[model samples]
Target chain A: MKLTTIAFDADDTLWHNERFFTLTQDRFADLLSAYTERDHLDERLLSAEKRNIGHYGYGIKGFVLSMVETAIEVTEEKVPAHVIREILDMGRDMLRHPIELLPHARDAVVAMAKSHHRVVLVTKGDLLDQERKLSESSLRDHFDAVEIVSEKTPDIYRRIFAEHGDGSERSMMVGNSMKSDVLPAIEAGAWGVHVPFDLAWALEHAEAPEGHDRFRVLDNLGQLAELVGEIG
Target chain B: MKLTTIAFDADDTLWHNERFFTLTQDRFADLLSAYTERDHLDERLLSAEKRNIGHYGYGIKGFVLSMVETAIEVTEEKVPAHVIREILDMGRDMLRHPIELLPHARDAVVAMAKSHHRVVLVTKGDLLDQERKLSESSLRDHFDAVEIVSEKTPDIYRRIFAEHGDGSERSMMVGNSMKSDVLPAIEAGAWGVHVPFDLAWALEHAEAPEGHDRFRVLDNLGQLAELVGEIG
Candidate 1:
């Protein structure tokens, strides 16, 4: 397959993301320790996130909102105003957190930029948060295009590929999430290259497509350029 | 003076948006009536919105967050958890709110769709919220493309017009906000048409361009098609 386009997922794929969420989640647990156990709070928060995803979509803001909702619910609507304020502060801190690029992220993007292939960042989250992260990441110039979507569906991958590159057949998507960045892209008739980040969010987990010819996995992003060359 | 592209802004430009915010603000004031005066609450909420715009960007979510922050601030952290829950519920209600298309919104879009020019929906707000509104509006099929941005600026307009249409010189942007939808668009070397909505957000208020050659204003969307035709 001639891969004329290489799309990368942001968040955990290019930079440290899920860890920040984990850190915030831990902080959330601490803030509510008096109201409920950590595990219960996590389950409720996750459930709230699942329920609210359709409404709020994905982002730090949604996560924080879910935490607040979960806090209110667990405390039986007795969650202190200061706890809510602290939760909001955590979200602000997350939004303002400096971008920390993962190893070889810049190199991989730079390689794709130098190559003939179109380099696009296909991420799903709050438009402003994604735009802010990308702007802060100092790697925006390496991309030919940026698509901050609400979700990564098969149809979305198909449309993005068709719009930014030759098509799905000539495109490859690289990222961390099996459910979001990999499987849907593979289903869209493109190469789905998984570069596993150490910490994965439970919502993003999925059974790996082991036997699919178009599916591939790498230990890290360092080998991405070589893999692209091999595929070409 | 060839107008090959006609771009329209979403939110109050094509639908009843500011009224909902006003309604939500009213509810918020009632919830905190014990703690602060209505005018004082409004002022605090506006200040919070302005300060938090950089972090939260724009949308019902941010607005709700700002309201929550204002509630906490106004009450000096004495606000009850039920009030916060009510505020969260208000945000959900706003997100789930049905689209109310403004006068002649459909006809104007249909008119532009039938014309030779490419029609594009250029909006700035929460991605999912805007998408939901567009989908619910049933006017999605009329436009050639949709651009939901974090903010609207001259550079953004130029890039959008160039990517989706011919370029800024051959494009015209129609919307409600003088700050967001008109002035920057005109600055980008495109025709900026203002369709004044009855209730305008204070943040979006701007002095109307009195005599700019490429600027025009209308009473409603009903006159948009005729205005475009006259310009051409």
Candidate 2:
């Protein structure tokens, strides 16, 4: 089927996102080093994130909140107020951090935009944070539409494709996370292109659909446009 | 111009939203009563909300973050971990609270859905929270579209109207806040209908546009469908 629409996942797929989360998490471990081991602290924070995802969803704000909760839990409700303040500050810093486009991200988006395809950015995170990142990314103009969703599920992929393009059969989704970006889109009857990033969030991990006919993996985004050409 | 679209604001307009925030603020005041006077704490929290809107935007998560920041500031960085944990719990509770429809909210939406006009929910807040509220409100199927934005501006209103309906000239925005729901939509060349809620956030206060031809103030949503009929 001809790809009438190409949707790219933001965050790690288009730019340097998880790295900031990682950096802030390292700072979190350091701040609470006096109260717990680094590994245990990390584990608690991940659990908090997973547990709170239903409440807080995804973004720096939720991440910061989870960090605060973890610190309190690990310290047995005695985590210092200064530590909480520092954690909030780290979240603000993350919110205000400059957008760094991943390698070949711009070229891939430009290629898709210039093609006969409808180029869309489908991302799930804090709406304001995602909008701010896109505005600062200098890649906003290349996209025909931007959807900042609450989550990336099969139903959501189906609706987005139907709304923004011909249908799921004539659309494609490319991203870093198999669980969020690739598998769901593939499940929705669309081409799912996986461009593996160097880092992945623990919650976003899933077994790759290696045997699926529509599933394809790329080493980087540099080969994305060429692959699309081959598919077309 | 013939009206083809009616966009309703979500929070204080279609649902009992600001009251929960008010209730939470009362709890916040009580939690920090030992550290400062209630009036001073309220003022500080308002200031923090205003100052951090650019950083956090509008939502319960931002409100909670501001509360955390205010608690630390007012208590001189010794607010105690329990207070922080309490604040985080408050945020989670807000997120999980069941949806409460405002007066005539359901009937007005139903009437608009039956009318020959496109009905849309235009709101500014946390994406997930808004979606969750809508999903629980049992009013989801009534609207033609839902636009969860960071902020409502003339440009945004213009774009949304153009995308969802004929144009701003043939559209109307009904809501509680004169600042967010009325002014910008009117500025975008659409009719702005104000349905005043009893409580208002400090950030949302603005003078009513008395003489504007396209501006109309309703006591509640019960008069909305009739007003649309009159406008048409």
Candidate 3:
């Protein structure tokens, strides 16, 4: 697999993103400790998010709103307004939280930059928040392009790979989500390398494309440079 | 000001966006009526939103979060959790609300396509929400390009006008906001046309450039086609 362009997923693949979501979620559960059990809150919130994804899409904004909705559902309309305020504060804090690059994310990209025609970051989230994170990641200079897309689907991958890379034959996507970063790229006829994250969002988890010719798995981003070297 | 490309702002300019926000705001005020006066709630919510924009940027998501925050502040942490839930419901309702096209938005764009090299829709908000709105507006085909940017700055205008249109010299930006749509485009050396909206967001309002050579004001979007024809 001679990859001419290497695309990275920004959230969990390159930086510590899911961990923030998890932390905020824990706080959300605690804020509603009076209304319901922690486990129940988590379960209900997940369902609300799944049900509401079509309407709200993905990202912290959607998550916070879902939490608000879930709070109402679980509390049976008796949740204190102050608790709602705390939930809003939790979302604000998450947004303000600094971008923490995962181990080896920088080195792997820097190494791949040597052989790749284009090193790109294709992330889907709030545009302003994503842009701010990219600049703060201090890795923007290494990328040939950055895409803040609404969703990651086979069609979007096909379009982006066609525009930014040489094409499927010479492009590869490296990321954490099997649902988003890997399967879509593989379906688009490009190579997909999945690097697992410990706290991957439940929504992002899916069975790996085990028999796909262009698919591979790495334990962490640290192995990326070597994988690219071999592939290149 | 002869123009090669014409751009329109999406929100209130193309469709009735701020109206949904206004309706939701009224509901939010009513939901928290026990905690604060409607006028005070409106004032506080607007102030909270303005304060939070730097962090959350813009959208229904930010506005909903601000309402939650204001509820807590007004109630001094005693607002009922059910009230918080109601606010979340308000946001969800807004998201699910049908698109209402502002008068003349379609005809104006149809008219511009006749005289311009490119007709573009430049909007800033949630990526998915904006895409959904554009498709729902059924105005997608009218635009040669759709820029869903994080923020509207002079630099962004310069870059987009250069790439999508001929350049700032031959590009014209027509929209509802003096701050976002008109000022930056004018500063970027493009012709700026302000079509005033009565319910324009407070954050979007600014002093008109009274004597700017290329700046023009229309009472409504109804005047846009004729104005574009005259300018072109």
Candidate 4:
């Protein structure tokens, strides 16, 4: 019953975030199909990220600016203002989206809350997008606090655990991403549980090295609740 | 016109290899859809690779055996003999495949052979599978020598260039995979050209950092011949 603090990731974790990014990207590709190549578009987006990382920050809105920049650069002076408007509107749709929690996300968070565990939501992205999502989800009440981080380094996890938890073996991290979530937590002397989700990138899905026993993989979030409950 | 040695990679560079593995995997997933999960299948295939790397070396044949081993383990000896046959058949097809050269692969190699280039086929895989592919391709005449390596390390490129081209800038490496083919060659002070192909694994597609002067990216082998001819 020692597991006290539970940390969760936000994007593609509590709600549908990446699917929107994927969909927007597909549409952007479709828009640029006549004028530019996917690789070129990707490079332009990368460039825009480099340019705006200090100003616009990161997430869908930053991606939106990059797409606009790419379109303008590729189309030269021939860029129709209407096309720019369309892309901006697309960005707006992303911002205004209703938070659709993944299956068992709400139930698990609610269960953890009722059990009086110190639940925290740790996520990386544009501050406004993360804030908008939390406000929309209405499940933010379940978490004791939320941390919108710039990156998910091991240091960040250690800092969070130290500030929020018993700073011992009672802290655990749950996430769908092995790289960003489980591995870093394990490195920070916290237990990690991995719940693999569909649409995980190939780089993110690499196998855990043999005999890495501090981590566990779950099929569903329900199983996570059961594990926490069992330990509690 | 100092380009002396030309090296080519096997697998997708010369012929079809990974697609067959992918097809077999999809079919295997279909067969085990009822009993085993896709993620479980993925985990076991990865596990088998880790387990057998010391024993079987690396390549398509090793991957096939891993698949077979995974099937048996997952099904608990209840898998039918026919199903096992199907898995074995997929492996055999890979081994028995006539090394069908990519478009302009043979013509470009022939052109280089007729020119002053010391054509070398440098590939990584199970030694037997790579040898079989070379023999089946009828490309034996095109290459003065062939190197069947276990892994494509930067050291491998350096050693090959030094041994084959007397450690001169007159050596060049050409292949479809960027991580293995181009970067290592560039890093080893040899000319490198990337011939991008469809369906490259994410691991094989690492980006070139900005401002790489010694590297070139070509759309096809035809372009590669022209670029080499121009450089020479």
RMSD of every prediction: 0.8, 0.8, 2.1, 22.7
Give residue B217's lDDT in candidate 4 (0 to 100).
82
Ten-residue stretch with the least lDDT total in model 2 chain A? A111-120
TM-score of each: 0.99, 0.99, 0.94, 0.47
Q: Which tens-of-lDDT digit does each residue in B112-160 have in candidate 4?
A: 8998688899987644456567877998888877776656777878877
Question: lDDT tens digits, residues B19-133, model 2?
Answer: 8899999999999999999999999999999999999998999999999999999999989999999999999999988888998999999999998689999998899999999
DockQ of each: 0.85, 0.86, 0.71, 0.01
The regions of model 4 sitting more than 4 angstroms off are A1-232, B37-40, B43-47, B50-55, B72-82, B202-205
- Which model, 1 or 2, shows the larger DockQ? 2
Off by over 4 Å in 3: B114-116
Model 1 reaches what TM-score against the true structure? 0.99
Q: Name the weakest run of 10 consecutive residues (lDDT summed) in model 3 chain A.
A: A79-88
Q: TM-score of the A chain in candidate 2?
A: 0.98
**lDDT score for candidate 4 against the true structure:** 0.73
Model 2, residue B171: distance off in Å is 0.1
Docking class of 2: high
Q: Which candidate has the top score in DockQ?
A: 2
lDDT of 1 by residue, A1-232 (tens): 5889999999989999999999999999999999899999899999999999999999988888888888889999898899999999999999999999999999999999998789999998889999999999999999999999988999999999999989999999999999999999999999999999999888899999999999999988899989999998
TM-score of chain B of each: 0.98, 0.99, 0.95, 0.87
How many steric overlaps are in each model, in order?
A: 0, 0, 5, 1
